[model samples]
Target: MPQEAGLRSFFLAGFECATQRRADGKRLDLLASTRHDAHVAKDYARIREHGMRAARDGMRWHLIETAPGFYDWSSVAPMASAAAEAGVQVIWDLCHYGYPDGLDIWSPAFPERFARFSKAAARFLAEQGDEVRYFCPVNEMSFWAWAGGDMGRFNPTARGRGDELKRQLARATIAAVDAVREVDARARFIVAEPSINVAPNGDSEQAIADAANYCEVQFAAHDMLVGRLNPELGGSPDKLDIVGVNFYPDNQWVLGGPPIPLGQYNYRPFREMLKETCERYGRPVIVSEFGAENTARPAWLYYVAQEVAAAREAGAPVEGMCFYPVLDYPGWENDRCCDVGLFGDADANGDRCVYAPLAEELRRQRVRFEGEFAAANDERMTPLRREAS
Candidate 1:
């Protein structure tokens, strides 16, 4: 079994904190949409009730840094304070696809300004009495690059500049890590990137090669961060600390084809994927973001937890699993409800109704992990007992 990854809990909750601009120039504040910002104290307390003592949350750069070189913590302090009070260890995302209004993402000033913001944020968190800090400097760089830079789906809205945007994000991530370390040397960083699998549509050589190449693209941001691909970007091994693999039900697909259904021959088992990621980076792995919609929630969690356990048995240091968007929020494109969380939308009194089935599954998995950890501890102490005898 794998050792604990220093988190307060093996299972974590993730609040959707995306603050990105849409293609039509509309800015999204998912934190506000989910009412997590207003009801964070109750939200944190609720997760703790479910036995989750850690979480993945975010700060809105666009809201915090309204102007150049000035940051107003009014938007973040309440959430941070709530987490501290609830005894939840949080991995805060510094950037989740949004930036300040006047900051040009393509210019050199982008990374410089981001570094300063990161430093300030770190200092502020430390001042709040957080001894150990975990930060995801820039969330999902690979996905962000493809969506915003290549597909023009969101902010920056550039076409055919995916690689360029990825490199820029990598630079900013490295700079953020350095800046944060200056304030808190014990700070750990998580690089959250989508974990995907692409298979061939047909047996043709061209199809196979295309599928393989497309699958390889998922690692570009991670590679750039560790100097494995781009040494000039100031990437080093330490910059890529914990590999936060964000997998979803639709993460695997045939190249240029439809998504591979679970249990299909073309669909890769998540355990194999986790093992591959661990071997590649040699870093502690965490399921950074994962959950399914509506009725599929419990089944999806069971599948992921089982696969994660299998991977750990195979010598992969799989640490933790996070159920992302633990609170349901409005869909990005349409304002319709996306019923994908363990907790439903907040009510008037700042309360959320828990989805009983998913919550029950989480408790079951937590008990199983606790048993495994205890067994592993006993195995480790056996030799010590013999020595003492």
Candidate 2:
């Protein structure tokens, strides 16, 4: 982990803020649905109590810019103020798979419009007392391209156009970085995408090669942003900063088959994936989003923490791990509750019940990290110790 990243704590809380429209034409606002928007002050304070002095949140572009060239900060101002007041450092997501209505994602003007929005957002955050701004220009570009473009599961439902959608997202991301930098040159960016492993179901040579190729597609967006691939999109190394690898238990799967069991022979160790990402990008990496539902939560966190510890010892620049959706949210497709957060759904008073098992596991991991890093005299441990204490 680089000291320059300046994360306030080793563990981070990620609020579920996806504002995507489903295939059924229903737009979802997770922040609102989870009541985090209304209770942001209490939410930030709660995370601090849990030793998470930093968070990943989002800005709803649709609500902020309801019309062309018009800006509204009413929806975001309170959250920003709460973070500042609670002393929680936030990495804002500019677009979490949702955009303004009537905006054509394929048109040249799409990137242009997003750039302007990014500029405005940067300036606004700066004005709100965020001296050093951190932003994820677009969350999970590869996943979004596949879900909305290739699978027709979300907005702009089109099939067999994943690559084209990915390229356009790359263009938008590049434009956003430039636009943000124009507002504040010191602004940092996190390009978060899902990290996965695809295994061949059979021993056939063609199946093996196909699986490998499919796995490689995960890096297309990162490569594009760094100008390693699709240089025509105007990507350069500067556009790529911190690499955020979003991993879940189901990330590894057999080609054309079901998910690989956790202890299966073909299931890749999370450490190896973390190390590969760091080496591939030559930049700081963070487990930007990761969590499991119900009873699997504690075990999953334990697995990830141990793997991250091993990765760090092996010289991977793993910076931080974010327990995504720190507050449980309603399901995107169905309104059913997803019991995956450290905190349950908010009550009328904007308070939530803590999931004790996961919270205990998180505390244990924090202590373990503090001890290991302290023994190694790792400078990065300083912030963790200070925050956790």
Candidate 3:
């Protein structure tokens, strides 16, 4: 539990702050596309009013470091100040799947530049005098490698080179963490990597082993960060501070097959997944990103909340849950409205239309979780265990 060490609240909202070049070679600034860049203060205010005291937002690396060895705080400083003014605690992401165009991702220069950026960003936030500071240096290393290196979905656009890209990202991440610590020792990091599961479709030995191996691959980035797999890259136990695991409906599937529907015979329980993750890493875990699209959003939260509670009761250090993309935005590929956030896109005044159904469910879960914590005066608490009749 560690009351003082945990986030300002048990729930958090994440904005779509991705700033990256698309397959079409167009640079997409999500904060601008969603109008959050101009309405930073308003967005923070609205999220606070929703009863969430914490948020997950990011900076655009491409915009800030416009020139080599030169830094510009113009775009990011105001947003950080806005969050502080609105009284909303934020987990600032330094590099959200995008870096400067001139810097090659695989080049040693990439890590060098990122480390410098991390130091600068950390100093900026440290000077703000915030009590609790959280950061995600590199978001979703696993997915990014697959998309950018292997699948050619985004930047780097290399094919069949996901592993190489993953390692390069890991190296940069390690460097960034070190640099941040140098500037602000109190800064906490949230290593958010995708949580996934894979299974064999058939009953053959080879199929089962292959499926299991693929499933184990999801932890590669985490292992590297924690000094488990890649000690040669300066990884160590301290590298892994707080782990944030992102899970979605389609996160688990049979290898080379379709998704295993939650609650089905073939599906692994969400509680089991959380427990396994916590046990392996032995650090605090957050369901950092969890939400469904449209009508299923509310139902999805209930199921995830129940599983999180169960995992906590089972002695897993499940710290909290974050409903990511708390604000809706256009799709990355087609710019179509995803309609998946708790609040719709901002109107003319930067006001968002809250989805009543999702908001109600969020309120219910918040009250219930607050009550669960209220009974425990201990900072370190196991989940509220129910008594058997």
Candidate 4:
């Protein structure tokens, strides 16, 4: 282990299933595909150069074993291998969303299928075991269930309230952990979920209750992953190594309150949320995903770094912070996706050689938080004076 630097920077790697690829002369969704692409390996190499020790990659159970008892590792193996070779660690996300297409999510076989895929993935990785140790069984389970199951945003768009989604996602998380432990008992699980602070209408009692419930609701995934269900969720709390928070400005909002424009949301709001999450869970926190769009991002960078420092000073076990993407992704909602990348795009040959100023700003902020080193002036490490002899 690299002496627990107290803060870390990581790159995001969307799994084969979650990637939206330009193909068939048009964009095709690969959220449930098992086929791997060569481009991913190339991308990983580029990402590794950006000072990331950890990479957040997604893994879909549905894609790996599309049919009963059938398995395929071709899609993920290269990227995992690439990460290992590059000396980068991976926090593999299993089952971001959707089923293998034929199976119903409500079916009894869902949990077992997920477990099988996880176990197989863990086994293979362990067989090749280098530094790959962390596993995030599911990413943002509460939001996914709500969006996919309740809100109908993505596939398997079943509409329901918060409870069902919470329950099913929790079960899947449990099964996933069990599977991984079967293969690698020492594997650490990072539970990544959306952390939203719902500011209700004024200080009314109902509003307070609503806010509390909302906190718990967002915590549903973390609670279950660490086995915290208790009297309500019907099981013990699962073990959570890191509480991964995917927070964007949009996620923090008031009930029916006028939307706070993206530029208006500041670092204070994020700091408070980070503090609250730490206070609530009493676990080490990682701002798993954080970034903004359409502005002078260096200012944004300075502000976020200040807030992260505050989180650390306040005694929150904030282990690391990840900027989500090193390059912009095409066609995400509201052009926000395109803007989030630190490197906007590449040259004609797809060779990524330029770093956007925003990335420089990110680097700048990291240095401020981690402290700067003067090449020949620092006293913590130095050579003895030869004149003494």
TM agreement with the true structure for every prediction: 0.94, 0.95, 0.93, 0.82
Global lDDT of model 4: 0.61
Residues 171-264, candidate 2: write the lDDT tens digits: 9999999999998999989989999999998899999999999989999999999899999999998888899999898999999999998999
Ranking by lDDT: 2, 1, 3, 4
- Return whichever of 2 and 3 wins on lDDT: 2
Q: List the residue pairs that clash in candidate 1.
A: none
Runs of candidate 3 with Cα error greater than 4 angstroms are: 1-5, 372-389
Of 1 and 3, the candidate ranking higher by lDDT:
1
- Pick by lDDT: 3 or 4, better one: 3
Best by TM-score: 2
For 303-364, candidate 1 gives per-residue lDDT tens digits of 99999999999999989999998998999889899988988888899977777778767767
Best by lDDT: 2
**Candidate 4 clash pair list:** 17-31, 149-158, 226-237, 226-238, 227-236, 227-237, 227-238, 228-237
Identify the runs in model 1 with alpha carbons over 4 angstroms from their true place.
1-4, 372-389
Runs in model 4 deviating more than 4 A are 1-37, 230-238, 261-268, 332-337, 346-348, 353-355, 373-389
**Residue-level lDDT tens digits of model 3 in 158-236:** 8999999999889989999999999887878888888888879899999999999988888999889878887788788
- Which structure is stronger by TM-score: 1 or 3? 1
lDDT of each: 0.89, 0.90, 0.84, 0.61
